[model samples]
Target: MLQRRRLLLLLSAAGCAQRPREPSEAAAAPLPAGISCVPFARALSGIALAGDAHLWWHAAAPRYRRGTVPVPGAVLVFRRSARLPQGHLAVVVRTVGPREIRVTHANWASGSARGQVAEDQSVVDVSPRNDWSSVRVWHPASGTLGVTVFPAWGFILPPRPADPAELAARVPVAARLAAGTL
Candidate 1:
């Protein structure tokens, strides 16, 4: 009986040792390349406006409805800074929560993943006011929210029949709370 118990323990230990380890984020496959955020966002969201990723905000103003409210299908525009000298752009795939969203974009990751498209990546509003003026994006390579807080110009809505009144009517209650207008 004791011999059988020992054999069972050894078998269990062997099975544990033979278990395959889960791949670390670093060990994950590299993202494919040859695309950047602007064209990807433009094609994905059909916003049409072009330039550096940062310039899309102002360039979109005259042509597209612009606001701080995030909506699915809207393009979030990152402002230019020393870290992101040319800026960045991502299409809102969906809202995850009041202050969290999933975005699809390209060129956000570094190294081999640079210029590659990333889909359904997480982005969280880190602004004190919760107005989405600043954000931290998920880093696929690191498997965590990126440490850098990037400034954002806001969202550019797709061209449609939205007038100011209709746009104003669509502002979520959370946005009104952020604006202190609620």
Candidate 2:
């Protein structure tokens, strides 16, 4: 019986190895065209940021504060270059580590449907000096970190604070009372 089981296992392994690897969804789909990351990020974040991705940092200079630190609700600004003519913008969803963050943006995935965007995608700061001057973004199509590490201008934080009334409405009076903070 043991010998029969060993033979079956070997056959199963061989069968699995013989099957061809199928193309991933990101690979099979068509490349997205005419989908700008700017408008997509604006719609997702509701920050009311305007203009091309490359110009966001410059535009935010007067209204929003810019820095290297990654914060949720801030927009990451990518520089304009030959490869990325118009540049790209992504909203920081959260910080995973000192040098790692998750962001949501459009046009990151080439084959996605119209208005289809990537959420909570990993982005790592791989700058040689650890200055957040360069980064490698996760690529869904290839299922790996992107080969091209693009240069970044920095992060832009919005000036508006969360509405006090909105926060108060979210926490029920009973719940607040239970915590003895009501």
Top of the candidates by lDDT: 1
lDDT of 2 by residue, 1-182 (tens): 68645533432221000011112233323223233466545544445556667877888777778888887767788887766677778777678899998775655555433324455577899988776789988876677878888889988875543232332232232122212222
User: Per-residue alpha-carbon lDDT of model 1 for 17-130, expressed as tens digits?
Assistant: 001111223222433344556655655565766567777788886788898888887888888887877788877867889899877666666665444556667889999999
Worst 10 residues of 1 by lDDT: 14-23
Provide the overall lDDT of each model, using Cα atoms, as 2-decimal numbers. Answer: 0.63, 0.59
Show pairs that collide, candidate 1: none
Work out the TM-score per prediction: 0.70, 0.66
Question: Which ranges of candidate 1 are over 4 A from the true structure?
Answer: 1-32, 160-182
